[model samples]
Each structure stands twice: as structure tokens, then as C-alpha cells.
Target: MRLQGKLAIVTAAASGMGRAGVERFVREGAQVAAIDIDPAALKALAAEFEGVHTIAADLATEQGALDSIDQGVAALGGADILWAHAGMPGPASVEDLDMTAYRKAIDLNITSAALGAGRVAPHMRKRGGGSIIFTSSISGLVGSMMSPIYSAAKFGVVGLGKSLALALAADGIRVNVVCPGLADTPMKLGFTGRSGDPAEAAANEAKVVGAVPMGRLVKPGEVADAALWLASDEASFVTGVALPVDGGFTAR
Candidate 1:
């Protein structure tokens, strides 16, 4: 109930951390706008949440990001929190990287966050204050040899949070970033490949687990909880923080 009666907009909300965030916010008493690019997923989300507003839009563009926020504001009357969580991971290694794909990944992962916040800032300002939370990764703090592009993009997100925090503080708007370690999600499964040989899959899983000090992956709900805290009044004095929801991975 920390977010009772608040209005929120969560992008990439059809799956993974975004989907979990929408569910968590709703349970915390916030009216939420769940957005994603998948029409079928958005439809399912709308059906699943009676009062939630579901939006299907390509967040790779500034207009799409702005339009979705506009619709969300109109649906819920206004927005008190904006969680710009739309992103994609890039090549695991530079040798496997394609420039075109890398550009798209950076655009989707970094540019969308910047534009999404830019479009929503005015509306939050009109209300006198609001919170903006961007999604980052533990790779953001360090560098990922496996996915250098993803690491770079997430690093940009962390930078965005800090810069926006200082820029918007005068207007009572707080900007923060959540850096989650490896999480068990459909996307991760895709990246790891479920249909691979059993031995290969086991090895892959072991490799992932071995990287984290906790010996387990972060859960989507855990990331959502961190995001929920940042969006709620409990974090009123918290801003410009890159909170690590990682299981001590960054510690080592």
C-alpha cells in the first residue's frame, strides 16, 4: 500500500521484469498502464488486470514512447511514476556482433529510456513532482565481455539517472536506476536456448550460476520490488541512486 492511489506507467510490461513490476504496483494500490510492443501479450495483460490499462507500441521511437505516456495519462488521469524498462541485450561477443543489430539494441535499450523520460517529465512537472526509474544491469557498473553492447547501453542508463536526478531535483522529480543481476526470464531462456543439448544447457546454466556469488539468478519479482520501492513515497529522499538488486555479483 505504499503506492496507494498513485498512477504509474511501465514500459515493456508484457514480460520479464516489466510485467512483474506492473503486477507489483497494482498490488501496492497503484493504477498502472502496462505497455509493450506485443499486441497479443498486451491483450492478455489487459484481460488479466481488470483495471489496468494496456498499451501496444514500438518503444524504439520517441513518438511511440511519448504517445504511450499520453494515452496512459489520459487513461488514469495522470502519472506519478514512470518506469522506463524497455530494452534488449546485444551480442555476447564483439566477434559475433553486427553493427546494424548493435545499433538497434542501443536504440531500444538506451534511447528509448531517454525519450520516454523526456516525454513524461512535463506531465510529472505539472503535478509538481514524480519519480522516474530506469532499468540497468550489474554489467552497467562494470563491463560485460559477453555482451559489450548491452553493458554500454545499461551504463548509459545509469548515467541518465544521475544526470536527470540533478536536473529535475529542483522540480521535485527524482530519477533513479535499478541494476539487476542475471534474472530467470523468457528472454534469458531464449538467449541461453532451451532446445540445446541437455549437457550444453546444463553447462550454460552452470556458467551463469557460477558468475553470481549467490549461486542463483535474480528473479523478476525481486527486480520489481526494487523498482516499486523507488517509485513509492518511501523513497522520497532517494534519487540518483543505482541500486543493485544483484545477488552480490557486483561485490566480487
Candidate 2:
């Protein structure tokens, strides 16, 4: 029970790393508020988990991010952990610089996390201390030729996390960021499948996988494990760190 006696609020909790984090936290003895844009997914999650409180809210807007945190804290009484994990992949090429998609990517990938953290920090302070985990990408640490917009947003997340960690450290609130690489999540698959060509998607995934020193994609559960450690007492002394669970993708 690594997270025993804790209350957590997880954004993007319907699927991918968010869902995995929720499942792992619950099993480790934490009561969680699972927030996602999909009401159907939230309902399914609530039904699957005995004590999970599910909230349907878009995390892409400032109002949505704040309101989600409010609802979660109300439902769980207070929050000891906040995992602002909602994000999206933006335009793949500089030629396709759709401002709409690019702005949405910034809002969802980094702005919401910033808003959520601002909203949740006071609650954590009231509770003595807490842990806040944000999701970045290996692209955040480096750069990406495939998606410059994505890299920009992810880099913003990392910087925001570090700033928040420093700001909240005195209050006993620890903030950290997780950088994932070539993960086998719906988001990754969707990116590769965007061309609607099976062979192309397969080939794209293969090419990306070839770059990982571990010779495989990182699993959602593996990312969850890292978040769990950051949330639990095990990482009490850790803060302001951007840990990469990329199977050595950043090692090179």
C-alpha cells in the first residue's frame, strides 16, 4: 500500500497512462477522483473501480481544469496527489501548421496542467503537503522532427513542473514531471495510424521502436509505477525532477 491513506486527483483518467495510474493507485490503497473528457469512459471506469469517483470535464480549458480540481477535491474531501496527465499530439509537419490544432495542443498538453496545479496547490498546502506529477515526453527533453508543436508543448510542461516544484517545495508540495518515449498507448498508436494505412502505421511504429535501446515501447503500467513512486512516501525527498521512463530513448 504505497499510497495508503492518500486521496488523488488524476486528469485524463479515462485511458492511457492516466487510466493506468488510477488503477495502480487504487490497488495501492488510495482513493482517487478520475477526471476525463469522455463521460462514457468515466462511467465505465467508475463501474470497474469500487471507490473511484469519476468526473467528466475537458481539461483543455482554464475553466475546465479549475472546475475539475474543485469537483475532485469536493468529492475526495481533499487531495494529496494531483496527476495532470492530459495531453495530445499536434501537427506532424511544419507545412500542416493548423493554428487550431497547434493551439489546442498547447492548451491540452501544458496549459491545463498549469491551471490544474495552480488550483490544486492550495488544497495540498492545507493538507500539509502533496505530490504533483505532470506528463511530458522524450521530445520535451530533446526535440522531434515529426512534431515540433508537440515538442514545444511538452517542453513547456517540463519547465512548468520545475518552476512549480521550486515554488511549492517550502510548503511540502513536491512537483515532478514524467517523460515517456514511444509508449504503446492509444495516443502513440493514433499518431502512427493517422494516415489510415495499416502497413504505414506498422512501418512507422517499427522505425520508432528501432530507436529505443530497450528494443520495445514503454508500457502504461511502467509509467504508472514511476508516478506511484513519486506520489508515495517512498519519494518523499524527491522533487523538481524530470524522470524519463523511455527505455533509454534519451540515453542516446
Candidate 3:
């Protein structure tokens, strides 16, 4: 029970890394507030988990991130950890990008993560110390030929984590970011726009997998494990890291 007695709030909790974090944190004995825009999935999580509280809200705006944390603090008594992660891939090319859509997508990927962590910092500080983890991407660690804007947003997340780590060190709040490669998640399917076509989806996934040295996609649980470690007392001395759970994609 590494996180026993801890209270945590995770964004994007309906699926992907968010859902996995909820499951893992609860299993390790943390009370959690699961926030997402998907009401149905959040409802299901609340119904299944004894200590989970669900909040359906978009994390793409400053107000949205703040509102979720406010409700979360009220529900969980206080928060000891924050997995301040909720984002989606934006346009694949610079030419295809709609500036309006770009702003919204970047808000979700970078702005919300930074705002959410900032809002939660004080609450964690009040508890003496707490962990704050952001979900970035391997694209954040390196340039992406296919998604330059999206890569920029992910890179911003890493910068947020590093800066916060230093700013909150004296408050005993540790900040870190997790950079994941292609994972078997809805985001990947949506990125390819082939979620409905099994054959096409498989082909796309295969291509994504082939680029990874591991020959497979990273699992949600694996990324969750990394976040869990950073959130636990086991990582009391660790912070400001852009840890990659990317099957060694960045190494290449």
C-alpha cells in the first residue's frame, strides 16, 4: 500500500493513462477523484470503485481545471497527489492546422496540465508534501515530423514539470512528467481516424509498433506504474524528470 492514506485527483480518468492511474492508485490504497469529460465512463468508475469520486468536466480551460480541483478537494477532504494529465493529439501537419482548433487542442495538452498542477500545488503543500505527475509524450522529448504542434504542446508539459519541480521543492511537492510513446489507447485510434475500421486500425497500429524497439505498444498499466512510483514515498527524493515509458523509442 504505497499510497495508503493518500488522496489523489487524476484528470482524463475515464480511460487511458487516467483510468489506469485510478485503478492502480486505489489498489495501492489512495482515495481518488476521477475527472474526465466522459460522464458515462466516470459514472462506471464511481460505481465500481469504493473510494472514487467522479467529476465530468473538460480540462481544456483554466476554469475547467480549477473547477475540477475545487470539487475534488471538497470530495476527497484534501489532495495528496495529482496526476494532472488530460490531453489529445492535435493536427498532424502545420498546413492542415486550423488556428482555432490548434488553440483549443494546445490548451488541453499543455495549458490544462500546467494549470491543474499549479492549482493543486498549494493543497499538496498544505499536507506537508505531495506528488504531482504529468503525462507528456515521447514526442515531447523529441521533434515529430508528423505532428509539430502537438509535439510542441507535449514539450510544454515537460517544461512545466521541470519548472514546477524546482518551484515546489521547498514546499515538499515533487513534480515529474511521464513521456509515453504510442500506446494502445483511444487517442491512437483517433489519431489515425480509423477507429471504426478494424483492418485499417490494425495496419496503422502495426506501423506504430514497428517503430518501437520493443515491437509493441506500451500498456496503460505500465505507464501507471511509473506514475505510481513517482507518487509513492519510494520516490521521495526524485523530481523534475521527464521519465519515458516509451519502449525505448526516444533512445532510437
- lDDT (tens digit, per residue) of candidate 3 on 107-202: 999888878887888888888989999999998999976568889999999998999999999999999999998888878875655347878767
Candidate 1 lDDT: 0.89
Say what the RMSD of model 3 is. Answer: 1.6
Cα-based lDDT for every prediction: 0.89, 0.92, 0.89
Among all windows of 10 consecutive residues in model 3, the one with the lowest summed lDDT is 189-198
Task: Give a tens-digit lDDT track for model 1, residues 66-99.
Answer: 7888898899898889999988877666785688
TM-score of 2: 0.98
Clashing residue pairs in candidate 2 are: none
List RMSD in Å for every model shown.
Answer: 1.8, 1.0, 1.6
Deviation from native of the Cα of residue 76 in model 2, angstroms? 0.5
Candidate 3 or 1, higher TM-score: 3
Better of 2 and 3 by lDDT: 2
Q: Candidate 1 clash total?
A: 1
For model 2, give the RMSD to the true fold.
1.0
